[model samples]
Target: MTCREASEYLQELMDTTLAPDLERRLRAHLDTCSACAGELTLQREIRRRVAAGVPRQEVPSALRQKVREILAPREKWAWGFLPRPVIRWGMAVAALVLISLIPLTLLQQNREERIASIVIEAVNDHRSFAMRVNLPTLPTADREQVRELVEAKVGFQIVPPMGQRGELRLVGGDVTYFLDRKVACILYGKGSKLVTLLVLRDEGIEATEQGFRQVNGLRVYTATYKGTGVVLWKQDNLLYSLVSELPQEELLGVAKEMAKI
Candidate 1:
């Protein structure tokens, strides 16, 4: 699909309303086109922010009255002056959709926002390493010692997978706050590319198997949030979200290996 075609399907892709075949084609386009992928990521973030930050309230009577007045026999219909009963029926359906849709749309958006947020934040935090790479960090040559040092600072022991990541060398790590909860970010690198592993206490909302999949027989949640790949899994009281810009197969390969331990 060309960029133009992909753009048309993007909203449906976000809404999951596209046919499976079309969705696959658009996804293929996104995988190879960084510009479109970035566009999608931008749109998704905006949608999520609106869903999560907006306040919800019941429809006010004044607003209802205003709507009623507006819908009350506006002007000539394109089908040449519709009958009163026909107009009233149209108004009733429109009003039903408008008045009842608010809460339902809000509920759906709230759930989508919550689940989408499970990994988008990790994607963002990983992206931030570009700017923060120059910041001082504990040496990551020794994973065990690095983990301990991070625990000392963050007051939480993070168990990063002791599995082969091919050429990904541990760059460095730091402690930070996400949603007011203390967390650890361990950076790994191969050449100039990077991957981030975030460890934080489970806040309970992420338990749902929203983007769930099995990696090496272990259940892991995966998503393509913010134009990057993320894999999430929980062990004990802690949750692990691995974020990278790699293809899903490569990303999941590392994650499955990490899940082995």
Candidate 2:
């Protein structure tokens, strides 16, 4: 191949195996052209750095299915103008080019974005309740009354810490939508900082598992999503998620206290 032709196919040459004749000509040009060889070295180094710095993230199932659908062969394609082998080869090359361009960071971002959406939903719900014009919903500090109201809507009772007098007091109770299902929220505030204790039936919410800890005989799972601290535990077939911007220690303390109830 001439120097210009070799340069055009350099990336493809580096990426995959080429036809024997094409590979032979490219190597012949490289042997005579020092500049092209140096350019090839630089491209390899850049690719190496990109591969080393970014860890591979698994493709999401939905994206994998979509890719499969796109690559699936049709019954009688218009590309029949080309031989079957040629069509297959062209499709493979196109698929490889498309796949190579997808960065690992993109997959990681998809997962983080999903979790962030949940966090945003929680934050918005809290802000809406805090900024309400009036108490349009039930406002009660009574544990039994709040539990009955929340359980009636969510099928999960809000269990407060074992004492009537505690640092976190239940100011009110309300219902909110989380993952298309009703979530029972019990509002509590120590001072200016508000805490939303969300109780619901676990339906496999996607959360990165932090560390599991035993607190007050309950296996508590701790995780942070989008800078928001989250502590979840299960009891009586229901899941309790304590979400707030509070420090991890403070949040864990609240979760432990609730677990004691």
Candidate 3:
């Protein structure tokens, strides 16, 4: 391969995603191409620095306490002696209040923990899908369909990365169950770069004004998937997130697209 080709392939090589033959060719080109070698060295250094600088912080005790309070039942009354109508009305009101508070409580507890769980699941999904990258039997469209299938099967949606329609294309997606939650991951590729979007079940998120937050050193901006932004609220027992690595503007656009879906 030419020097430019090899240089472009270096990103995949760093991620260990390139085919063996192509990787060898790229390495040979790098051996003789000073510019490419220098570029790879710089990329490696940046990756190393990023890895060394970002340490995972533990969830704060205050947050944990708050979460417990939110998730913990406020009052438990024995209803065995109550009349049917009285018990039904009381139970319904209690359920409504509990449903309303759970998401708020979870948010108060630790948003970072929620985000970390999702990110880890996404990374695992990416690793699994990478195995099919070079499989001749897997068509590109089929890869994308596979991801969508997993999302459907797992009862979640996958947000395609930005610029996918015109520039980057859907590569694949995977479903992973982690922390007793289901996460759907959709992978997109632009040239040689790949980005994955992870969506966790929305049973635990609270309904509140949309906002932005960062976790695990990654910037996480939240908004509703279709309308204004995601309502940090809970429904049933799931927490929902429409997440992506696409820039904020593009992610917002994609969220709008998701609303249509």
Candidate 4:
């Protein structure tokens, strides 16, 4: 399997949900890739912590007392109505099964909530940054020159759109953090319009065609964001969003151009 496919299935492998053949493929990849191996180790640690930390519920005192009473012997004639030993054993087994399911159900709920929290935190951070910054000044040089300067100074390779001559004019940019991940936000302008392009390590969101999502009135576009006549695409696992009060069509045109790049 390819590295990307292996990476995608790593979580399933950790959860022991993958079919044996697929699991073997992923394991083989992990054995060779140090990065994937480290990721697997971290995932295993997280699973262990989650399992260890989730508190198991104890049987309620009232229920325990009731069970004891039911199991106790009685000399009264009414005892003749009691269940046979086999029926009693079946009921006990059913009760145990039901009780055992409670913890697993709670654990599933907790795991889902934890994942949701992480995604929400990432989206919120993006939204918060959008609200705080001002647009930067337009670049004085050509797009290629600006890209070269950015690469030299910022250490990130910036590729401009195809068939476009300096469509996005570089403005100021900043480095920021969200949820322990470092991010770089570059301000750019197309003509008189201004926008923000964020280069993040990763937002932890799955890649999909439904890339644009709005959170708390902040319009976030993943892989690409368009504003005015400029489009931005995320390159190198970094997220890029053009935050501008521009027309959607123009933004889409810019996105198409960037996709070629």
Candidate 5:
């Protein structure tokens, strides 16, 4: 190998990709040329330092706040509402993945996008409702009256599955919407565990063989968003979802029990 050839092969040598004959020739040239050997050593050192995974310098808190203020309009639509930094990244990615992935053709044929949309919304509501029960002042209801309140206010009759599990109790239920679809937000809890069940008109929300599992002969769509478990299934003309921090299998059981209603 000439000096020029050795220079050209330096990257491949560092990458361990040179052929036997060419690599032997390059090594022979490098052994005789002090300048080429030094260059190869320098390249190896550079590669080693880059592959070391150096820590990044975080921006100062004050500078970050200033940048956020300057970018508030865009950031508000992005991450401003998500209170904790820990949940922010996961939520943003999940939310973005569903939106950016669905093409027009897939939107017509599949329910994956719809599942993700509901899961994200359900988890958001689950977190908020868990913090503070969003009890409506006008049409309030206790455990016994939650079903009646949901029927009257939400324009749908739902058997709130408070009786499905021993550790579950009815907390609240309210009328909400996603796009133009009226949604029934049924909140339940037992001890410290929280569960939010959303009932909406079915919009082709079916469980595909790949992303869903059959539970008690029902196609159940179970997903984990952030650390929360989301179980979505359709019964009759309405779609149902149970969102909580409970184990997904438990959620599936609860969903299956709710489907029986």
Candidate 6:
């Protein structure tokens, strides 16, 4: 979809009401276009700030009566042919949906806030490698040495995936802890694009409702967090989350390929 069309549907996209095909194209466009990504981020931030500033108050009975009176004539004209009971039921369902959105929106905000912090930490750690901070335990391409180092540090046997060996070369790896559990944060590079593959135990991590998808017997969670695309999944008892600037589809393709190893 063109950028103009994308802008037109941005509200629906935020509400998660767009058709699946359209939503896919929109996300694809956002992935490669930094300008659009920034615009989306700005819009979301504005919404969050506005929501935070807004006061929460129950609708007054007089105001509700006025709104119903204003819509009564239009509803009567629009649904003149429909049965009264059917119209009443339709209005009830619409009210139910409106009422439920309040809590659902809050729940979504909390989930995104929590996940965003984790994603930001991962992204920052990925960037820290360039600064030569918290250097990897093993720097060679020897699989045996890397595996031994990872296992010894994290207490879990890990076979770091060889990502496009030459194109996306694995530079080195080190162990890090998340929520007290061992995590093997492996670093890989492809020209300017740096990828960090996190391997850890999935004991307490919760899969997001909208972010969860399945691929080749694995449960995948995909999200664009803090301007970075993250692909997370579980294999056996191990959880893996890959963080990068790659598009969602491209990231998923790379992830699936890596899972083969």
TM-score of each candidate structure, all chains considered together: 0.52, 0.47, 0.36, 0.35, 0.55, 0.51
What RMSD value applies to candidate 6? 22.4
Q: Write the per-residue lDDT of candidate 2 for residues 36-86, one digit (tens) a residue.
A: 899888898999899899988999999998887788756346676788899
Candidate 6 matches the true fold with a TM-score of 0.51
User: How many pairs collide in each candidate, listed in order?
Assistant: 0, 0, 22, 0, 0, 0
Tens-place lDDT digits, model 6, residues 125-221: 7666656776777776676676777888887778988755446777787787664478888877767777788888765455443457676655677
RMSD per candidate (Å) reads: 22.1, 22.6, 16.9, 23.3, 22.2, 22.4
Ranking by TM-score: 5, 1, 6, 2, 3, 4
- The collision pairs in model 4 are none
Order the numbered candidates by lDDT, best leading: 1, 5, 6, 2, 3, 4
Candidate 3 deviant stretches above 4 angstroms: 1-108, 119-139, 156-165, 207-210, 213-261
- Model 1: CA > 4 A from native: 1-112, 131-136
Cα lDDT, all candidates: 0.77, 0.72, 0.57, 0.56, 0.76, 0.76
Best by lDDT, which number?
1
Which runs in model 4 stand beyond 4 Å of their true positions? Answer: 1-156, 159-163, 207-234
By TM-score, who's the top model here?
5
Candidate 5, clashing residue pairs?
none
Comparing 1 with 4 on lDDT, the higher-scoring candidate is 1
> Model 2 segments beyond 4 Å from truth?
1-117, 132-136, 161-165, 205-228
> Candidate 1 lDDT, tens digit per residue, 43-133?
9999999999999998999999888878975543475477889878988999998988977764566544655665777887888785574
Whole-model lDDT for model 1 versus the true structure? 0.77
**Candidate 4: residue 174 lDDT (0-100):** 50
